[model samples]
Target: MSKKVLVVDDDPDVRSFVVTVLEENQYTPLVACDGVEGLEMIQKEKPDLVILDVLMPRGSGIRLYRHLKTDDALKAVPVIMFTGIALRSFLKSQKALEEFKGEKVPEPDIYLEKPVEPQELVDAIKKKI
Candidate 1:
């Protein structure tokens, strides 16, 4: 079976772009506009991976990540955060930043920045699986 990807983003263009890239690379893509819907899709579809965004009107990516961590069923699901904000910029302290490296966080197996390169996105997904 093909690996499925759930992509959550508020922007239509970003969602479209992600879906296109996933499809072009032969992965099935599911999209959601907000955290609520994205969570619902997760429950229903059980995708192989999730490509999450940092900024969404309904809820931030961190919010959704926190929620995912709370659920035992969802905790193992790999998420590749696609954020415009650089991870280093968000890391406050040197110690904390060093601790966060490759930790899957409200924890991810992998992380990626946007606008995501199609090949990079595909590589991340494959690596997660």
Candidate 2:
């Protein structure tokens, strides 16, 4: 069976682009508009990988990413931290510090900037799964 991937982003264009790419690559793409919804899908669908955006409404992607990293069951799922924000911002976010304390959360498997390159995104997904 084709591997499943969950894409969580608030922007419609970005989400659509990713979905199209995943479909073309023969991976099943599951989508969510926000982090909370993404988590729900992750728990229910248990996708092989996740593509997450940093800034979002409801629960932010960083928040959800941290949650997944800390959760025993979901920690192993590969996540690509796709964002328009600079890398330093992500490293400096309050959530980042809070989540990494005690038992540190694992860093995102990959980090992709906004306006993601189609081939690069595909390559990252391929490498992760």
Candidate 3:
């Protein structure tokens, strides 16, 4: 069966592009506009993998990622953080959040900066799933 990959991003253009790439590569693509909806879909669908973006409205990807990593049931699902945010900045915020929560979660299974080539995204997904 084709793997299901949930893509969470507020940007419509980026979401659409990712969806197309996944479809072309024979993977099923699921989408959510922001982290709020993304979390809902993640629980309901239990996708094989997730592609997430940072800095979304109404629940940032960072919050959702933290929740996933800390949840025993969902922690095994692979996540690829696809964002425009710099790696250093993202790590700093993640560290601060972990400190505040008194919990340390593992980093994403894969971290891909935005403007990722389609082949690169596919390869990452293939590796994770």
Candidate 4:
């Protein structure tokens, strides 16, 4: 059976794009609109990997990442941080700031910027699985 992938993003366009790409790559793609729904789906679907957005309504991707990272059963699942915030400088500064504030910001297995290339995403998922 093909591996299952969960994509959680607030943007419908991003979800559609990722889903289409995943389907073409022969993977089962599950989607959630926000982090809260994503978490629910994660429990229900138990996807092989997750493609997550950083910002969303209700709950954030970072929140879900933390939950998964801490949960013994789910911590092993790989996550990909897919966001519009892809600047290396910004990510570094954000990490530093969060560290200074004593916040725990765990890095995802892979980080990709918005407008991800289909081949790139598929390759990343294949590598993870």
Candidate 5:
């Protein structure tokens, strides 16, 4: 079976696009609309890789990454953090975003601005997995 991948973003269109891309690349793609849902998917699905969006409602992707990072079960899962938030571009990244933003959030394993290039996404996945 192909490797499973989880794509988490609040934007439906982005989720659809990412799923399509992963499927086309012969990967099993799972979709989640928000960080809360993403975390649930991670726990339930245990995908080979996770693609997350940082600036999400209710929960933040960066926080989710740290949660996974510290967890013994989820620590081995590779995470790709994509965010449209511009604040990080102007600030320095730390061990976590919550510390840097102080109410904002931290950065993902890798950050991508919106309008993601298809190849960039693929490349990121390939490297992580």
Candidate 6:
């Protein structure tokens, strides 16, 4: 069976591009506009993997990542942080958040900065799933 990959991003163009790439590569693609809807879909669909963006409305991907990593039932699912934010900036913010919460979560299974190449995305999905 084709693997199901849930893509959570607020950008329509990004979502469309990712969906097309997944479809072309023979993976099933699911989409959610923001972290709130993404969380709902994640809980319901239990996708094989998640491709997430950093900033969004309703809830941020950082919050979603925290919830996923801390949840025993969901922690095993692989996540790819696909965002426009630089990795250095993201890690710095993540460290501050962890310090504030007094908890540490593992970094994403893969981190890809946008705009990502189609082959790179497919390779990441394959590696994770």
Two-way TM-score contest, 1 vs 3, winner:
3
Q: Which candidate wins on lDDT?
A: 6
lDDT tens per residue, model 5, 38-76: 889999999999988877886777667777877889988
The lDDT of each candidate is 0.81, 0.91, 0.94, 0.87, 0.79, 0.95
User: Runs in model 6 with CA error above 4 Å?
Assistant: none
Q: Give the TM-score of candidate 4.
A: 0.87
Model 1 earns a TM-score of 0.84
lDDT rank, highest first?
A: 6, 3, 2, 4, 1, 5
lDDT of 4 by residue, 4-103 (tens): 9999999999999999999999999999999899999999999999999988987887678778887889999999888888658546755875777676
lDDT by residue for model 6 over 18-54, one digit each (tens)?
A: 9999999988999999999999999999999999999
- Cα lDDT of model 1 by residue, 57-123, tens digit: 7877767876786689998888888878777754333236346653434446676877767888878
lDDT string for model 2 (52-108, tens) is 999999999978988999899999999999999987788777455775675566668
Candidate 3 per-residue C-alpha lDDT over 18-98 given as tens digits, one digit per residue, 9 for 90 to 100: 999999999999999999999999999999999999889989999999989989999999999999998889999989988
Pitting candidate 2 against candidate 3, the one with the higher TM-score is 3
Give me the runs in candidate 1 sitting further than 4 Å from their true place: 89-106
Clashes of each: 2, 0, 0, 0, 3, 0
Q: After superposition, how far is residue 72 of candidate 2 from its true place, in Å?
A: 0.5
